[model samples]
Target chain A: MPNRARFIVQIILLFLITLHARPPAAHEAPPSVRAELPLLTAPAISREGYFTLQLQSLPTVPLVVEYSTDPQFTQVTAQYPWFADFSQMTLSGFPNGQHYFRLAQAGVDGSAPNQVGPVVMVRVQHYPLNLAIGLLCFGGAMFGLLVVMIVRGHWSRSRYE
Target chain B: MSEPISYALPTSLGVALIIAFGILWIFYGWYLGRKNQTHDDFALAGRQVGLALAMATAMATWVTSNTTLVAPQLAYQLGIWGMVGYSFAALGLILFAPLAARIKQLMPMGYTSGDFIRLRFGRAAWWPFIVISLIYALGWLVSLGMAGGILLQALTGLDYHIGMSVILFICVGYTLFGGLRAVIATDFIQTVVIIIGVVVTAWFLIDKVSLASIHQNLSDNHPKLLDLLFPAALMFLFNNIFFGLGEIFHSNVWWSRAQAFRKGIAFKAFLIGGLLWLPIPIVTGFIALAAPQLGIYPPSADMIGPMVTAQVLGKVGAVIVLVVVFSALASSLDSLLAATSDLITRDIYCQFFNPEANDQQLIRWNRLCLIGLGVFTWLLCLPQVATLAALLHFTGAFVASTIFPIVLGLYHPKLSGRTATLAMIAGSTLGLISYFVVGFYVAALTSSVVSMLVCVLGLRWSTTSFRWQQLQESDGC
Candidate 1:
């Protein structure tokens, strides 16, 4: 009974040690959170369709987004207001072309913007016909082989039987 | 690790489900255990499994963690070609139909795949073959174990170790009581549950987000997903075939099932099972495509399937995903435990350790092996080191090297045992080098090609007539 108690104590200590050893969770804020500004991430070259835009920041902080086809900030095609929980958006009906987007911190106090993220580009292009043909040929060949193997097996078994 | 995400289901409900199903399965397996009177009865279920049960078990066992999580993951990562490439794995089962028939005819009294290897290729080849089989089995067991923990933590706020431990215990308890009989019987019911859960989830998802809108969304936003010529996905398509073929062709799991089915049932069971399994990945893969539409960006790709279901369908969808994944994990875990322990019991224990061990002694040791293996796997799964896809594919080089040797050793007489051993060693070495040098996608492909070259050369150089009658010799004490 005494030995059993010792074993239990050891196990508890081990568990606590391991738990303490683990790194902080991904969403936890480090000491340097005040130093590094949050950024927006998107694909460099996306296909012509709906795509997602992800915002990397503390979950508590709100951000606003602006997108446009023009490289310059003369025209703002879309705008999203300050939202905290919703960090991702799916934009659709993007014609085959290049588009630029940027994000700015929603001013907590009524004043000038604190920080503006760099502009990122997303290119939407049509599907390649050659790649499609290649996929078709490979798929067709695989199907044909499956058929041939099945038939040959049946035929061989019949002859042997 | 990220902050352990929580789903809608309460912890109490998850615990209750696990306990209730665990008890029910144990009782069912024990009831089936009443009929066992001999070693063969326990190990091979008396070799009289009918068509329906056989087909159900085959399909259920093959729809593993890879299909549930990795299928969606690939789709999310590689787009349209990912799920389509995954569906190609069903061909392994389809192609094995003829091979299963041949196996049964060649060795009617065979106990395990190891028995065949030992008989066909003397000690020279059997050693390397056993090592390869053990590595692949453990690789698969650990993958399933990790998936269980990950699935539970994602659904409820259950601790990873607790969830993983409970699942391993439940599967081990039932498998220990019933042997292969319990495994197959539970598999039939589990198959029904899985099919229903997936179909309902997909139905609700499609109804919520129409396919037309998804197409337009992808066409406008992520065109590479629909591109006919996706480079990496294309390479993945061809490479995935070799992985599946190696998994089914060499593993003792399928070999034991092939030996268990009733006369003339193995071939048809595999064929039907393959056809049923082909469409499942496609449907599951389609769910991943809806991620962009649903605005889901998961921390890890493996969680996309469950996260999408939970978000779109709410608590009810989370419960469905939980049940399907649990059932899938249990089916494959139980089979691997049964089949791998059988190999150790029959091949190593009886064939080597105790040649005079009787049927009853063999049964006792088999149970012991299961308990020991369950404990070992639980320890390994405690540390979530790698993702599901990465872990499963890492052993591709090891398993793929055995494909050619197994196929040739079964049918071709010209290939000598010495040559087979050399081929396996050389093939696996080159394959592993390529795995590190080239990429994960090419590991199996490179291994199979190298193994095939050595085998063809061996056949041309050697002349040894392996008599078919020798395969039926009773070497299992």
Candidate 2:
């Protein structure tokens, strides 16, 4: 029991090098909330397919907008806006399927993360082929069983002689 | 020194150790070849394998290249459940004990499970069974070959092609010379090394990183990783159980081991192996919590477990990780060699090519086939391009997807071999579609279900029912 307890403790301390990769403990401040800031108070869009993103920030605090199909930070928009009407903003720039958007509230002093929102998982539906051959297999089995039965019965009848 | 236990080995030393170990492993075969006893000595060690060794080999083989490489990949990204899902698959072996015992009773002197398929089902079914086993054997060879290459790239600075070719060539050389003796003896040694290495890494890692810390860190930063009740996690676990059960039940690898055992040992080994194997993936996966915090993102699924070891423990730590992986890779590769060679020699050669061949002639042919298969896989492994998991999963899916035919064929003697074959053809093709259409994980489940349905329905149409007790004692040819 003591060894098991010691074993458990040692593992935790080793894993402590990267805390956020796991769930937050009772005492720890959630990293999600630590990322919150006033200058970059961008309203996170809830439903990714069709939802308006609202931005709330000081006029002096210029916000840079970005969107991407991936959760990664490769998609930054050139256009700056105090408040860009997302209805006019082209959603077409984003890929056809689910995407992520990040808004940065920035001052000239520093461009650090004011805040980050939830990571969204989206499934895109594209119609194509799936398991159709599986259906064909069912058809084939019926045919084979039919023949096996025919042969088995003939063999049985001959054996009766 | 203050790092995690998994990080104790250096990367350079790790790679060198793996290469050194492979060279040493061949000698076991060379030795086995010198003792040219009867078929008993070659195939089953005259039924002399100890409980401990038997237990270890059974567990080691079931663990597979996938257990070390693929399980952690799924665990890291798909979250904890991916690892859990795989670990849960061990239940398949446990459930299969009854079947194993029945087989032992049916074929006390069986050479391979192919024997059971041949005698009860007759020649009409033998060819179809052979074809299924053929696809499985060759496909397994290629996947393990691919795994060896990936392990090389991870452990050493070696190119994928070189690493893979080296491993395959070495495995083939010994397997051709030694037959089942080489495979099982080496499996025993590999199992010992693997246990020591894995137990140390997992134990040390667990001691270093507490369960409490993992829960705390994941909840605070990446809550997704800690969600044990995640929906995908739930589906993944159940689907994997069925997938695993069907695969182990139907395949010649387990079948050959069962045939090689004393009448009772096969069942005992499987039950014990299943229990022992249940914890390995979970222990290794807990290390992945360091991925995000350490800024170590795995390039591919196969790299996650070792990469984490390096990030947390540094170069020396990574080397210990390498030794564990080497053990896993060898254990799985040797099983593929022995089982595939058995399939070719017994099913195709003796049954179809030359039925008049004596035991001595056929045993010689088995050794030759072992060499041929080894060479074939070695050549295939020379060009390494695909991710480790993809190579195995896709190929494994090709064979694993056919589990339905073997299972249904065995239990319900009325099921037409035609139905089993066609269902397999259907299952494999459709399984490929599912892999591309949905995802790799779901494809396995879909194929099993599709094949089972065809088997069940086809049996209903047959006029004669099967008697379970009438099974044959003859195995192979």
Candidate 3:
């Protein structure tokens, strides 16, 4: 197709997207996760906040993010692809001791629609972003060393001359 | 009869002032630093920009008036998490320090990330990436311009059109003339004024009301807003990182800085710039405390920081607020003009129009393009925009997906031209789909994953085949 025709399609697509985009729900999808897809195995109340949820997306997609909470269930969020950090969150807002949090899954795309799963809740506070943080540091440090080496090589060449 | 006075100059007057300032600044830059003949001089101040100057320029520019003027809505509605989330954007500059060096090494002659996408990704995929990246740059430039007019109207009582036009002319004047050199020099001064304005306002707020008292006020008055892990707040971190990284990774604005800095200036400039940049949002956010009792809702999020400053420090505060906001406007506008000019000159001009344009000829057009771009940008910024984040995110989501392209493309030889191009198109298309189509970060995330999967699957196919002979032929090694 000519570039001009492609441009028109692109603009039309943009306008349609805006018109269809619902205000995103608290989690990736609102209306909750699918009950049928993944079973929430764990019990409703425990000391540390934990929960497991299962559902499929991609019109039949499987990957989903899960989060558990203390009762009062202050915050709940799910990003598509359900990376590790999106699922781990500390419980705030609820009173202390036992709190039950629910779980569900939805496709990031609007296709299959996420359904509410059976709520298997664990109580908890402060889930770590250790893995992601570790990667950031490791990547940053390795790049720093590479930069240093290159700069040093230049410095040494001038010195030798 | 005296109308309710806005300290902002009349729109017409503001326009005149803005253009005059632009002209004045350009000449000053030209007089102090003659024509920068080489890419190094034109892009960076001979790569000798000190940490203080670099840090200031980075901070002042990144925190455009929208950040100061509007972000308070987040603070007002969401509480602490909102401002803190906004401040986290500084991490973009800090973390990017390491990546800059790698970029420099990979494309020593590169003018924009556009060049990288084009070079790494084959023809089938380049146009989508180009459209996405350019859309983002233009969107950002326009948003800042919109903010400039809104700010001028609020503060000085100027007409919106005149205010915006004035602001645009001022930015174009210096950036079009001085290139990056003028932009960087003004950033040094802009930073100082911004710091002074934000800090003094914060100090006064703290003096007026104790931190403990403010805490008590939040707990009493708007308890839910203080809820730490509000679902929106929790989502804010990842969302911001995606938004920030996209700009840092894909936009030539940052890439130009990376290239311009002398061999080592990239790391220092980005790092120090990030650190100094981090504390500012927090300082500005804290000032909202002074008006806890007043129930002072700003005109919009963009109005929050300035309104708070005005409320706490009074008219004198308003003056300082305008200066600080203007500084930010200048820093970003100048950097963008130079970066965009570089893109047009190197990628488009040299490639399509004049493959053999000599260096001198290239420099001349770069200047001309810089002027032309400034005018184009100025013309666009004159319109009003509704949601700053909507505008920002529409562009940001597409750019964010490029992280896969730049990072993976650098080290992974297996990530071939076809794969790179596919990855960019798939990621951006999905991102746009999520933002515009599906209509949320979650959907956007889904699109990014799908795009990523396509790239990964492609990678797996090529990797698993393990054509050792083909690797020998194609690999940079």
Candidate 4:
């Protein structure tokens, strides 16, 4: 059973990698952040590939996130806009590699160029193939039991008649 | 304050729709009431409901707003196990199928579940059973009422108080006119609406966001959600099963339905209802998984399902979600109102207040009970004390304690009244302590285990062999 489980895990991982294979797309953060609001800490990376960006900014000022693979930062890989009570943003969809993220705010009415914050580096992890297989096995067993119960119930009813 | 989220429907339109549906349902109930010649007819639908309506009402009442709203919230909070765990709740209905058959054979003339408790265990057990039943029923009612208001406000930006009041008024009005017959009949239509609306929303969601993408996204970002070995989620899986069993086994809601369904139909109807309901939480829970991918973050997790549907499908989806939620809420609110009122009328009023009360007086009292319960529920909902899930589970400690007593009492005659009473009190007290100390996830689990142990002890020592024939006694008799 363990051998079969290992094979299943390998197959799922291969399937996921193939499905997620995509042409290189630009992922970058917008340039510049208003200096008044400073980022409290660098974006923290979780085991799950989510990048949590925490900043000390006024609620009124909308924040934008910029990411880039290039250290010179000429090309932007991804951009996300954040607007809500919490000065925190959780970003996903970054491929498994080291990437740079920075917070920025576009000046109102283009009055000033984009204000940029300090850049932070984070790394995304490999897919959780083992967890996926375990979840599927559990779900499959449950549904299988349900089907058996239904058939048995109906079967018993017919015989009693 | 930040502006409330936008919705497709106008507030006036939503209000008008509720009022219109309310008036129509009440009139329909009055029409059905014309056939209600006796109190039994009113309360049990003359115990002649056929296969189709029986199955529909059973499935619809069990759906509740929880199936639509909380299933998604659970999925969002607990991951894959959350939804799969929720779908297991259908086991309650499936398991109850045979029990329903037994209930009908034992008490053909029974009025409520209280009747069974009183006959089996005497007054000592009956009192705590009533308190537990009342608390569970009222908790469910207030939660359903609050869900309606929250749904309308979420979808159409309507005032919470107005939306909440309107739903209560509508359910109370119809139930006041028709009783169980009305509740069942409305449940049939509501079931169709709920099924069609949810299927449509789910279909559109799948088309907009493929399951592959949803799977890959969760696997990528929210790996814990897909983690089968998640500790909290594992605890919730068993706790929810116990809670569902306790709710169905002990509450008058399912008891009344069992009594109302035609003789042979009760078992099959519940079986079929459980089957029909098994897939719903899966469909609903899938929507919440798409929430993170869609970049839609609701202020409250309970609101994720509706918020996601609206943002993805736009205005038309919002309308479908509103109608679906409305139907689900009404189906449950109306059933709780009808069943709980029957308990009050038969157990409290007829048994204690006036033993000489005739069928006409009892029927009138049932209608009045519905209105009074509705008002009380509305007032409780006004405070918005807790989230729907929290409020429902708070009573979990109380209801979960009844599982062992009820199952043992139904099957094993050796279970004594003293043992049953002590089990409930000890189980509930300890369960509440666990809920405060450990967490909500283990409240039902601990309560069920404690209750089971006490019941087994009673079974060992007690020598009484209860005669099933005694269950035929009328309350006043």
Candidate 5:
């Protein structure tokens, strides 16, 4: 009786582990073949170091985007899983450099990705910090002058009245 | 592997709520409008608004769709400074408090800001000022109209065009019936709704997503958003301040309110209103910072605020967002429609066509003008021209140019009409060039500086002084 109980417990534990380790059912399905790859487009230049990439003709399968600093993507910087299947993805916080991005059907069962889209590059060039600070100071001075003018004008008018 | 969570509210339910609110407002408008026996009562609310209503209208009208929608969009794009910068807009109201008192004293029977420009600066300055005023008013109207659609679609998955048209029709219906009286009364109630809804949403967001986590996620993923030295955001701060000042100083919307409020209320009411409105953007804006942690990447940036709220709190949250945004939209939209129509009727139609038009004729024209402005705004909104913030800042170039001229013309005796006119033209021209050449962030700042320089030059060069009494124009109606 003791041996039989131990055997049952081991079987239950193995089943639970297997259930937890199985791949999601959606990913197990065979990938759909498409006539044309999704068209990816991005702005030619981004002054703010951020731009949106638009994917047209998106496939039903889950997608992943890989971005790198090089055209050939020799050393991939990051691979982002596209969330919620949105057509437009806005990637921000690039440090004022050229970044290349492309979309692909995420690999299933540890297999290679299928149908990679053409690469698009976005050049990010931020405004000069000095110019930004200069404008800020100019604005501050003008605002101060405005306050002075208003206060003086009001005081003078009140005195006269 | 999970599907995207769909919109929180059902289309039918959202439509039902809008229709219900529409009926309530229109009925109330008609109920209050019965007391409007003359054009004065219709246009200026009989100049008898008490302190409480005065404060409510000031706060509510300034709490525009831009505050609720665009504030979050800015925060999402520009980070912490975005919200803080937006709060700077309350300065427009705070600064306008003293100006409001002066406006009342100067032109106790004034109909619009245009009346002041025309009377104080004469026809030369009046022409450019009128053009700027109309362009800004139309831009604001269209933006409000578009906001109505965007908010509805974001929360309920409703079609943008339908939502936009319904909101416009509803606001026009109420304003046409009740006039400024209805607008103010509803604004008081909408103010309550907006405050409670916004606080509730913010509280829930903070409770669900800890601020530390939000900060951690942003720091790790989008480091620029947390950077204090963000260049574009730094430039945007003062430009936004000038934009707000220009918006309030030159728009007939605020002027009409200043004219409508009872004696001795404009200053304190605006002061209190500005104080109450100072923190709203910060509360609304920080919610967007939680989006990345929740895996909510909105298709468009403008939808970030509602999407995150709805995502966290589900259906109830969607309902709250819908009501709050709808109220914000209506409060400003109705005011803009009524005020812009007043400008057209008093400044353009009556002043140009028939100065002898009686009270009854003026009232009729005012109502017709309301419809006309609504239709024109609808036509502009149909195209979904640009994002709300982009469209709004585009008009900043035109309105900011008028800021210095309006301020100096009001107080400085030596600033002549010709100089003011030249100032507006030069400021607007350079501002537009900067907008295309540099960016929208500098449009208002550049415009205000140019206008100020022109005014300073005029003050030095001029020999004449403006008589203050010229502002007390006789109400022909």
Candidate 6:
């Protein structure tokens, strides 16, 4: 009877170890745990290369964000470690293109796995260069005219004063 | 996250510093207040400010929270053009030098820019002008208040509300006690602190990180920042210039300065002030370009300046940033409080409610108005609406519209009051439309163009010639 009880206890302990030993998968997480995964949201379009990425909630663990050209994130272009406990991050200096991003839990050694959240897309479209140049010329002309007006006005007014 | 970003300075230290500065400034204000014997002395520093004080006040006021905070923000957001574009704001002071001379000559007794608009144009123009001035003043006050909160919170983790209220209270206390006299005297001291702090911080940043590495990192990561022909930045350049011009041309802040300086001092002081102020934004701005290399990403763009400084220099950096930002905030906040109150007291209260008010009565009204303005500004700043740059640029539409009208009214005799009124209205309407329709980069430009067109047409068609003598109201109307 004692041998039988020990066998049962060992089986239970083995079962618990097996359950806890499996590596955590972001998608395979239980429904309740998955529901707490942080969501990443970004503007649909960015006129400038820079745009802000907002997380739905504060990250409880260290997180790194990976970006790719494709939604599947097959080939990660870059990874940025979210340094602080901030819900929002302003990323700048991207060349114009469509980018896909996803958040993942960073391991103790800085390896990012257990990807969380849905993939987000941001399309970067810069303003037309010609329009910018045209505005610049127009502005320069106006500025010059203003300078002349002020200098002349000052000079002319000074003689009388 | 790696240890949750900790502030370099503790909250207790920040609170203690604020208390110390607050007491010192309030005491100094009381000391200066003893000399204010009349309304003019309270409102315009007796119109006796010498060149040294005049230059220092002008430079210090221009080196506002905008310079310390928004300049770096723009550089971070808009790249090379941002700092360069912001430095263009000095042109406002430079151009206003001539206008300052003209202003001093035209209305020797002028108390506010609204006074000039009312006497130069009629009631029609005065209404819109006053509305624009008040809105800009309030916007500036709220921005300054917001900057103070942001500065303290970024460095010391202080509550935003507490930091903001302390700054506003300190500024209002000083301006209320000593009026323009206290504002100017404090401004001189603040200017010294700001210059020394900013230079030291920049010097340390350069020592810690080589410019080549910063340049290389930006080139690799943020290539657009290096692009000379960046679209949004290009558009922002001209828009910012006009915004600065509008801000200086129409604001009671600059007008009161013009009125305060001694007769021979106005032009030179502004000129010297502008030249001195020209390079400050560049110094403040370049530090932000180094942010990414240091792996410091501010949750908000406006905090980048102080964050970068703190990240590089640690606790000492925090102390320097706090003191410099406090000085920058106080210099401009006190000036705005004193100037705006003068506008309300003289233009609105005296003109509308009681023209028969004596010097003592006017002084009392000005102090009350100062408190009211401070309270109203605090209420507005509580919500912390929009980024500092956005809040500042929104007023560009309203103020930019006044540029041509003010210029024409001062120089061109053919521009009548009705035409000037139409110009301001049309300019402001179109500018606001553009602000919503296109982007912030076009608002001021659109306003300036439209207003100039209206003024040109007015000059061509109008036969009315305004006599400059009408501005010299003996009863201080």
- Top candidate on TM-score is 6
Please provide, for model 5 over B1-477, each residue's C-alpha lDDT reduced to its tens digit, 9 standing for 90 to 100.
223345777776777788778878888998999999999899999999999999999999999888999998888888888889999999999998888988998999788998898888888989999999999999999999999988877777666777888889889989999999999999999999999999999888888999899998888767778877788888999999999999999999999999999998999999999999999999988888787778666666777888888899998999999899899999999999999999999998887798899889999999999999999999999988788888999999999999889888878889999999999999998988999999999999899999999999988999999889989856454
lDDT of 1 by residue, B24-142 (tens): 88778889988878778888999999999999999999999989988987887667888899999998898888888889988887888888888888877889889989999888999
* Model 5, runs deviating above 4 Å: A1-37, A57-87, A104-116
Every candidate's TM-score, chain A alone = 0.49, 0.29, 0.28, 0.58, 0.65, 0.71
Flag clash pairs in model 5: none
**Which residue pairs overlap in candidate 6's backbone?**
none
Ranking by DockQ: 6, 5, 1, 4, 2, 3
True contacts kept of each: 0.03, 0.00, 0.00, 0.01, 0.25, 0.42
**Residues A1-161, model 4: lDDT tens digits:** 69967964674454334222221111122223344545735544544344456666533454556668775668865555543334455453344567787766634553332667778887765345564355345534533553454346445545754
TM-score, model 1 to reference: 0.82
Tens-digit lDDT track of model 4 for B291-407: 767755454567778878987898788878888888899899989999999999989998899989999999989889988999899999998887777788888899989877876
Tens-digit lDDT track of model 6 for A1-161: 69967964674454334222221121131222322558889999998788888998866665777788899878987666664556777777666889898887754444446656689999989899999999999999988988888788888988977
Deviation (Å) of B32 in candidate 2: 2.8
Worst 10 residues of 5 chain B by lDDT: B1-10
Per-prediction TM-score: 0.82, 0.71, 0.69, 0.79, 0.91, 0.92
Q: Across residues B343-362, which tens digit of lDDT does each residue of candidate 2 receive?
A: 77767787778877776787
Instruction: List DockQ for all candidates.
Output: 0.11, 0.03, 0.02, 0.03, 0.12, 0.18
Cα RMSD to native, each candidate?
Answer: 6.3, 13.4, 15.3, 13.5, 12.2, 12.4
Please report how far candidate 2 places residue B31 from its true position, in Å. Answer: 1.8
Docking class of 4: incorrect
Q: How close is candidate 2 to the true structure, as a TM-score?
A: 0.71
User: What is candidate 3's lDDT per residue for A44-72, written digit by digit as tens?
Assistant: 44221212232223222233333334344
Candidates 2 and 3 compared: the better one by lDDT is 2
Error of 1 at B222 (Å): 2.6
Candidates, ranked, TM-score: 6, 5, 1, 4, 2, 3
What candidate 4 gets wrong by more than 4 Å, as runs, is A1-161, B1-5
Tens-place lDDT per residue, model 5, A1-161, is 69967964674454334222321222333345443556889999988765778877544566667778899988766665564434666666566778899887766654556668889999988788898898888899989998888778777877887
